[model samples]
Target chain A: MKTAALILSAVLAVAACVFLLAPLVVVVLASFSPTPVFDLPTTGASLRWYGRIANLEGFWPALGLSIEVAAVSTALALVVGTLAAIAAVRGALPYADAFAALLVSPLMMPGLVLGIALLQYFRAVGFDAPLAGLLVAHLIVTLPYVARTMIAGLSRFDFTLIDAALTLGCTWRQAIFKVMVPALAPSFLIAGLFAFLASFDNYPVSIFLTDVRTKTLPIKMLQYIEEAPDPTIAAVSSLILLGTIVLLIIADRAVGLSRMAGTSD
Target chain B: MPVTSLSRRTLLKASAALAGTVAMPSIVRAAPKEIVIGGPAGAAKYFNESVFPLLKQKLGVTVLYEGTNSLTNLQKMQADKAAPKFSVVIMDDPVMIRAAAEGLIVPMQASAIPNLGKLVPGAVHLDGMWANYQLPWAGIAYNTKSGAPTSWADMWAPSHKGKVIVPSIQNTEGFWNLLIAAHLETGKPLAEAQYDIDAGFRKLKSLVPSLLNVYTNAPQAMNLLEQGEADMIGGQFSAYTLTRKMDGAPVDLAIPKEGGFAMPSGIAKITGGPASDLADAVIDAFLGPDVQQVLATKAVVTPTNLTTPRPAGYPDPATLFAPDWGFVAKERGKWAERWTTELL
Candidate 1:
C-alpha cells in the first residue's frame, strides 16, 4: 500500500511539472521560428525575431523604465515590509493579525480594479507626475510578496537567541546584527526575488499610471503585439524565461532548494 | 534545519549595497520643440515610419506619437483637461464629437486648414472640429472557403450559423454592426437607422444563433479569422482584413449589397497647446491629396480627399453608408447595456 501511494505521488509530480512547462517550451520554440507570424518553424530555426527585439520602437526606454521601477520598488518594499513583519512578530501590538492582513490585502484585489481606483484617486488628489505614480503603484503591488514571506519567516524564528547574545557580550544592535539577520537571510532573498519579479512584470496597474514618455516593458509589449502579431514577442518571452531560470538556480544554490521550496516546513 | 554560519553584518552590508545600486538620478531634461499626437497603437508604427519624417520636413517641428485605445484616450483627455498633453488627437468620429462636447478639443478655423476644402462634404464632421482623413469601413470579413458571403443576411443563413464572430457593442466597429442591423431590418438608409433602436436590437438578437463569440476588440476578431475558428466576422475593420490578406491569409472583406458602415477617422486639436500652428500644418499635410493617396494604397483606407482617386481593390467610399455618429454617441451607453442583455 505504501509503495503504490509513493509511485502515484511521483507520477503526479512529474505530470504537474510537464503541465506547467509545456507552454513555456512552445513559446521558446516559436521564438526561433523564421516566419513573421506566430507559427512554429517546421524547417529551420532563425534568430531574425531576436534581432528585431532591439529595433522595436521605444524598446530601450521601456526596458530601462521597467528595471528602474522594479529595482527601486523592490528595495523599498523589502525595508518597509521587513520592518512591519518584525513589529508584528515581536512587538506584539494589539490586532497584529489584522494589520498584517491589511498590508497584504492588495494581493487579493484584482489588478485592473486597483489600477482604475488608483487612476481616479490620483486624479482626484491632483497627482500628475507619471514616474512617481508608477513607483507608488508598483510598491503597492510588491509589498504583499515581501510582507507575506517575511511574516512567515519571523513567526518561526526564536528571538531568545538575540537575548542570549546580549547577555553574553553584545549590545542590542550588535545582537540583532550578529544573530537575527543571518538567521533570516533565506527569507530576505526569497522575499526580494518574488517582489522584484512581481514589479517587473506588472501590466494592468502600470497601464493606467503610465503616460507617453513613461511606459513599462509589459505595456510596450502589449502595444507591440497589437500593432504587429509576430514572433518578436515570443523572443522577448523566451529571454525573460531564461533570465528567471538563472535567477532560480542562483537562489537554489544560495539557500538549499528544499528550503527555498518551503518543503521542510 | 542547519543554519549557514554567515555573518549578519556581511548580509546587511550586501543588501545595503544592492539597494544603493538601484538609485536613479532625477534629471529633468528641457522639453523639446515637438507636437505630441495621441492615437491607436495599431496605427503608430505606420505613422512613425511613414508620416513623422514628412511632418518634420513640412512643418519643421518634431512629432511624438502616443499610442493607446480610443476609450482610454478619452479618459486621459478628461484627466489632462487642466493642462492638455496632446497637441493633436486621432480617434473615431463619434469619440471626437464626445470630446468636442466635453470641451476637450477646439474647432478648427477653415482658413487654418485650407486642405479641408479638398475633402468631400461627408468627410467633415462635428462642425469642422475634426475632419476624417481616412474612411475605414465595417463589414463582413470571411474565409475564401465560406462560399463567398456577399450580404449581411448571409450571416443568418443556416449554413453560416454558429460560424460567425461579431464585435461587442463596446468596440467602434460593434457600434457599426448595430447600425447595419438597424438599416437592414428597417429598410432605411444608414442615416435613418439611428432612430430605430428596437428594430436594430431585434434584428441583432435574431442573428444570435450565428455567433461563435462576441469579441471585445479588433485584434481578437482578427485572430479568430486567422485561426479559421470562424468562417466570417461581422463588423470587422477593412484595414485588418487587408493586412491579414497581404500576409498570405486566405481572407477577404465583403461589403454586402445591403451596404456596410463607414467609420470616419479624424484628427482634432486639443484645446490649448503651444504648437497650434505646427499641429494645423500637420493636419493639413495629412489631408493633402498626395498623402491621401498614400494612405489609400498603403493603409487600405478609403481616401477622403476627392482629388485623390480610390485604390483599385477597395470599395468606393460613396457607396458605403454613413451612420449618425453624433446620435450614436449620445445613445451608446443605454444601447451597450441593451446589447449585452439581448445579444450576448
Candidate 2:
C-alpha cells in the first residue's frame, strides 16, 4: 500500500508538469518549423522564422520599452513594497492588516477594470505622458507581488537579530544593512523576480496606456499575431521562455531553487 | 537663517510654477509635419512597409501609425477627444459610422483630396466623412480538395453537414453570415433582404447541425480548412483567404451566385486634429493609384480606386453586395444579442 501511494503521487506530479509544460514545448518546436503556418515540423526544421524576428515592424523599440518599464517598475516596487511590509510587520502600526490588504488590493481587481480606471484617472488629472502613465500603472501591477512575498518573509523573520547587532556597537543603519537585509535576501530576490515577470508580460493594463510609438513586448507580439499568424511569434515566445529560464537558473545559483519554491529552508 | 530658508522656498515655488507653464503645452502639443494614423495591425504593417516612405518622399510629411482594432481606436479617440492624438483613423464601415455620429471624425474637403473623385461608386460614404481604400469581400472559403461551393445555400447541403465552420457573432464575419442567410431565406436581393433580421436568425438556426464549431479567429478557421479538418468557413474575407492561398494553403475564397458582401476598409480624418493639411495629403496618397496598386497586389485587398485595374484572379467588384451600412450600425446590437442567445 505504501509503495502504491508513492508511485501514484510521483505519477500525478509528472502529469502536472507535462500539462503545464506541453504548450511551451510545442511553442519551442513551432519556432523552428520550416513552413509559415504554425504546425509541428514534420518536414524538418529551419531557422527562417528566427531570422525574421529582428526585422518585425517596431520589434526592437517594443523590446527596449518592455525591459525599461519592467526594470524601473520592479525597482520602485521593491523599495516601496519592502518598506511597507516592514511597517506592517514590525512597526506595531494601528490597522496594519487593513493597510497590508489595501497595498495588495489591486491584485484582486481585474486587470481590465484596473486599466480602464487608471486611463480615466490619468485623463482627469491632465496627465498626458504615455510613458509616465505606463510606468505608474506597472508599479501598481508589480507592487502586489512584492508586498505579498515580503510580508510573508517578514512574518517569519527574527527582529531580535537586528537588536543584537546594534548592541554589538553597530549603528541602526549598519545593523539593518548587515543583518536584516542579508537574512531576507532570498525573499527580496524572489519578490523582485516575480514583480519583474509580472510587469514584463502585462497586456491588459499596458494596452490601455500604449500609444502609436509606445508598445510593450506582449502588445507587439499580439499585434504580430493579428497582422499575420505565423511561426515568427512562436520564435519570439521561445526566446522569451529561454530568457526566463536563464533568469531562473541565475536566481537558483544565488539562492537555492527550493527556497524560492518555499518548500524548504 | 530663517530669511535664507524663506527665500529658498520662494525661489523653488517660482521655478516650479515657471516649469509647469513651459512643459505642459509641449506635452500636449502635436509635433509639426507629423501625422498619427490608427488602424488594424495588418493594414498598418502594409502602410509602414510600403506607403509611409512614399508619403515621406513626396510630401516630406512623417507618418506615425498606431495599429489596433477599430473599436479600440474608437475608444482611444473618445478618450483623447479633448485633445485628439490621431490625425487620421481607418476602421470598418460600421465603426466609422459610429465614429462619425459621435463627432470623432469630420468630413474631408473634396477639393483637398483630388483622388477621392476617382473612387468607384459606393466607395465613399454618403456624407463624405470617409472613403474605402480597400474592399475585402466576405464570402465562403473552402478547402480546394472538397471542390468549390457555388452558393451560400451550399453550406446547408447534406454533403457538408458537420463540416462547416461559421464565425461566432462577436466577429464581423458572423454578422455577414447572418446577412448571407437572410439573403438566401428572403430570396430577395442582398440590399433588401438584409433588413429582415428575424428570417436570417431562423435560417441560421437550421445551419447549427451542419456546423462543426463556431470560430472567432479567422486564421485559425483557415488553418482548419487547410488541414481539411473543416470543409468550408462561412463569411471569411477574400484578402485573407487569397493571401493564404498565395502562401500555398490548399484553400480558395468563392463568391457564390447570391453575391458576396464588401467589408470595405474605410479611412477618415480625425476632427480637430493638428496638421490637417498633412492628414488630407496622407488620405489622398492612400487613395492614389500607386498606393492602391500596392494595396491590391501586396496587401491582397481590392483597391477602391477606379483608375487602378483589378488584379488578375480577383473577383469582379460589380458582383459583390454593398449593404446599407447605416442600417447595420443601428441594428448591430440587437442582432448580436439574438446571435448569442439563439445561435450559440
Candidate 3:
C-alpha cells in the first residue's frame, strides 16, 4: 500500500509540473520558431526571437523602468511596513487591530480599483505625472505583502528577551535596535523580497498611475501583444521567468525555502 | 458705531491679504517638452521600436506610448485624470465617443493635425473622434473538420456547450459582445441597429445561458481550441489564423451571416502634451505603408488605408466577415451595459 501511494504521488507531482510548465514550454518553442504566429518548434531551433528582443529599442527603457520601480517600491515598503509591523507586534500602542487593518487597506482593495482611486485623488490634488505618484502607488500595493510577512517573523520574536533587556536598564530604543532588529532579520529580508516581487509584477496600479512617459515593462509588453503577436514576446516572458527563478534560488539560500514558500504573502 | 465700522474694514483687508498669498502655476509659451501617447501593446511597441527612432530624429521630443487593453487603457485615463498624465490615447470609435461623453478624452485643435482631411468621409468625425487608425472586423472561428460547422448560428448548438468558448462580456469584451447580442436579439439588421440600451440588455441576458465558457482574451480562446478542449470560439483574426495554419490546430472560422463589427482605433490629441507634434507624426507613421505591412503580416490583419497594398500571408478583407462600423458606434454602450447585466 505504501509503495502504491508513493508511485501515485510521484505521477501526480509530474503532472502538476507539466500543467504549470505548459505555457512556458509553448512560449519557449514559439520563441525559437521560424514561422511567425503559433507553430510549435519541431526541427530547427533559431535565435530569431532573442535577436528581435535585443534589437527592440523599448527593451532597455522598460527593463530600466521595472528595476527602478521594484527597487524604490521595495525600499519604501520595507521602511513603512517594518515600522508598522513593529508597532503592531509590540502592542505598546492602542487600537492595534484597527491600525493594522487601515495600513493593509490596499490589500483588501483590488489593484484595478486602487489605481483608479489614486488617480482621482491625484487629480483632485492637482499633482499628476510625478515619480512620487508612481512610487506611492506602488508602495501602497507592496506594503501589505511586506507587512504580512514581517508580522510572521515578528511573532516568532521572544518577548521575554525584550522584557529582560528593558529590566536591565537598557533604554527602549536600544532594546529595539539590538534585540528586536536581530530577531526580525529573516522576516525582514522576506518582507523586502515580497515588496520587490509585488512591485515587479504589479500591472494594475502601474497601468493607471503611469503616463506614456512613466510606463513600465508590463505596460509596454501589453502594448506589443495587442498590436503585434510575435515570437519576441516569448523571449521577454522567458527573461521574466528566469529573473524570478534566480530570485527564488537566492532567497532559498538566504532564508530557508520552507519559510519562503510556506507563507506566501 | 465707529468701532464696528473699523472691524469690518479690517476683516475685509485681511481676507484680501490671504488671497494674495496663494500660489499660482507658471505659464508655458512653447508646447511642453513631451507628449504622452497610449495604445494597445502592439501599437505602443511599434512606436517604441519602429517609429520612435525617426520621430526622435525629426521631432526632437520624447513620446511616451502606453499600451494595454482598451478597457484598462480607459481605466488608466480615468485614474490619471488628476494632472491629466497622458495627452493622447488610441481607442475604438465607440469608446472614444463614450469617453468624450464621460469627459475622459479631450477634443483636439483641428489645425494641430494638418492631415485631418486625409481621413475617409463619414469617418471625419465619427462620434466627435477623428480616425487615427481603422481596425478591421472581429468575429467567429470554428473547426471545419470537427463536423463542419459553418456560420454563427451553429455556435449555439447544445452539444458544443462547455466545448465552445467566447470572450467574457465584462471589462474588455463587454462592449463588443453587447453589440452582437443587440443585433441577434432585436432581429434588427445592421442598418437599423441604433443605441437602444434596453434592447441590448435583454438580448445579452438571453445569450448568456448559451455560452459554455466566457473567456477574457484572445489567448485562452485559442488555447482551448488548440488543445481540442473547445471546438469553437470567438477571437480576433490575429491569433485565430496563426493557430490554424502554424500551430496546425483543427480550428477554422465560420463567417457569420450578420455582418461582424468593423471598428477603428484613433488617437485623441489633447493640449497638455508637449510632444503633440511628435505624437501626430507617430500616428502618421503607423498608417504609413511599411508599418502597416508589418502589422498585416504579423497579425493577419489588413491596412485600413487604401493606398497601402495588403501584405502577403493572409486572406483578403473582402473575403472575410464584413463589419458595419456605423452600426457598432451607435449602439456600443447600450449593448455593453446589457452584456454586463446578462452575461456577467
Candidate 4:
C-alpha cells in the first residue's frame, strides 16, 4: 500500500509538470516551424521566424522599454516594499494588519479596473508625462509581489540576530546590511524575480498608459499577432522563455532554488 | 570577488543613468514637424512600411503611428479631446460615426484634400467628416478542401454541420452576419433587413447547431479554416482571407449571390489637433493613387480611389453591399444584447 501511494504521488507530480509545461514546449517547437502558420516542426525546423523577429515594426524600442521599466520598477519596489514590510512587521504601528492589507490591495483589484482608475487619476492630477506615468503604474503592479514575499520572509525571521550582530561591535546599519539582508537573501531574490516578471509582462494596465512611441514588449507582441498571425511571435516567446530560464539558473547558482521556493531553510 | 563588485557597481550606475534620462526633460527642443495618427496595428504596419517614408520624402513631415483597436483609439481621443494628440485617426465606419457624433473629429474641406474628389461615390461621409481609404467586404471564407459555399443560405445546409465558425456580436463581422441572416429570413433588401432585428436573431439561432464556435478574434477564426479544423467562417473579411490565401493558405472568400457587406476602413482629422495642414496632407496622401495601389496589392484591401485598378481576380465593387452605418452605430448595443442572450 505504501509503495502504491508513492507511485501515485510521483505520477501526479509528473502529470502536473507536463500540464504546466506543455504549452511552452509547443511554442518553442512552433518557433522553428518552416511554415508561416503556427504549427509544430514535425517535417523539419528552420530559423526563418527568429530572423524575422529583429525586423518586426517597433520591436527593438519596445523591448528596450520593457527591460528598463521592469528593472527600474523591480528595484524601486524592493526598497519601498522591504521598508513597508519592516514597518508593518516590527515597528508595531497602529492598524498593522490593515496597513499590510492596504499595501497589497491593488493585487485584489482587477487589472482593468486599476488601469482605468490610474488613467483617470493621472489625468485629473494633470500628469502628462508618459514614461513617468508608466513607471508609476508598473510600480503599483510590482509592489504587491515584493511586499507579500518580504512580509512573509520577515515574519519568519528572528530579531535576536540583529541584536547579536550589534553585540559583536557592528553598527546598527551594518547589522541590517550584513546580517539581516544576507539571511533573507533567498526571499529577496525570489521577490525581485516575481516583481520583475510582473512588470515586464503586464498588458491591461500598460495598454492604457502606452502612447504612440512608448510601448512595452507584450503590447508589441499582441500588435504583431494582430497585423499578421504567424510563427514570429512564437519565436519571440521562445526567446523570452529562454531568458527567464537563464535568470532562474543564475538565481539557483546564487541561492539554492529549494530555499527560494520556501521548501527548505 | 573584486571583479564581480566592480561589475555590480557599473550595473547600478547604468540603471541610475537610464532612470535619470527617462525622468529628465529634453534640453534640446526643436520645432516639431511630426503628425501623429491612430489606427489598427495592421493598418499602422502598412503605413509605416510603405507610406510614411514617401510622406517624409515628399512633404518632409514625420508620421507617428499609434497602433491599437478602434474603440481604444476612440477612448484615447475622448480623453485627450481638449488637446488631441492624434492629428488624424483611422477607425471602422460605425466608430467613425460615433466619433463624429462626439465631435472628436472635424469635417474635411475639399480644397484642403484635393484627392477627396478622387474617391468612389459614397466613399466620403455625407457630412465630409471622414473618407474611406480601404474597403474590406464581409463574406463567407472557407477552406478550399471542404468545397465552396455559393449563397448565404448555404450556411444552414446539413453537410456543414458543426463545421462553421461565426463571429460573436462584439465583432463588426458579427453585425454583418446578423444583417445577412435578416435579409435571407425576411426576404427584404439588405438595407431594410438590418432593422428587422427579431428576424435576424431567429435565423442566427437556427445556425447555432451548425456552428463549431463563435469567435471574437478574426485572425484566430481564419487560422481554424486554414488548418481545415472548420469548413467555413461566416462574416470573414475579404482583405484578411485574401492575404492568407496569398500566403498559400487553402482559404478563399466567396461573395455569395445574396451579396457581401462592405466594412470600409475610414480616416478622419481629429478636432483640435496641433498640425491641421499636416493632417490634411497625410489624408490626401493616403487617398492618392499610388498609396491606393500599394494598399490594394500589398495590403490586399480593396481600394476606395476610383482610378486605382482592383487586384486581379477580386470581385467588382458594385457586387458588394453597403449598410447605413449611422443606424448601426445607434442600434448596436441593443442588437448585441439580443445576440448574446438568444444566439449565444
Which has the greatest DockQ? 2
Candidate 2 chain A worst ten-residue window by lDDT: A169-178
Q: Where does model 4 exceed 4 Å of error?
A: A92-98, A152-180, B1-31, B188-197
lDDT-sorted candidate list, best first: 4, 2, 1, 3
Compared with the true structure, what per-residue lDDT tens digits does model 2 show for residues A75-163? 77888798789888987999999999999999999999999999999989989878779988999999999999999999999999888
User: What global local distance difference test value does model 2 have?
Assistant: 0.85
Q: lDDT at B75 for candidate 4?
A: 89
TM-score for chain B of all predictions: 0.87, 0.84, 0.69, 0.88
lDDT for each residue of candidate 1 in B1-344, tens digit (9 for 90 to 100): 11223335435754674455434442243246677898877777667766776677766777767877787789989978988889899998778888999998888877999888889877776678889989877788987767567888888888877889987776688876677778789998777776898888989898998888997656666666665678998877766677667656667788788877787788888899558888888888888887777677656788888888887767777777777787778988898889877776
Q: How do the predictions measure up, each by TM-score?
A: 0.86, 0.89, 0.66, 0.90
Ranking by TM-score: 4, 2, 1, 3
How many backbone overlaps does candidate 3 show?
Answer: 13
In terms of lDDT, the poorest run of 10 residues in model 1 chain A is A34-43
Tens-digit per-residue lDDT, B182-263, candidate 3: 5666777644543544565675565555666776555545645655666776544442344344434555654466645444
Candidate 4 chain B weakest ten by summed lDDT: B22-31
Error of 1 at B72 (Å): 3.4
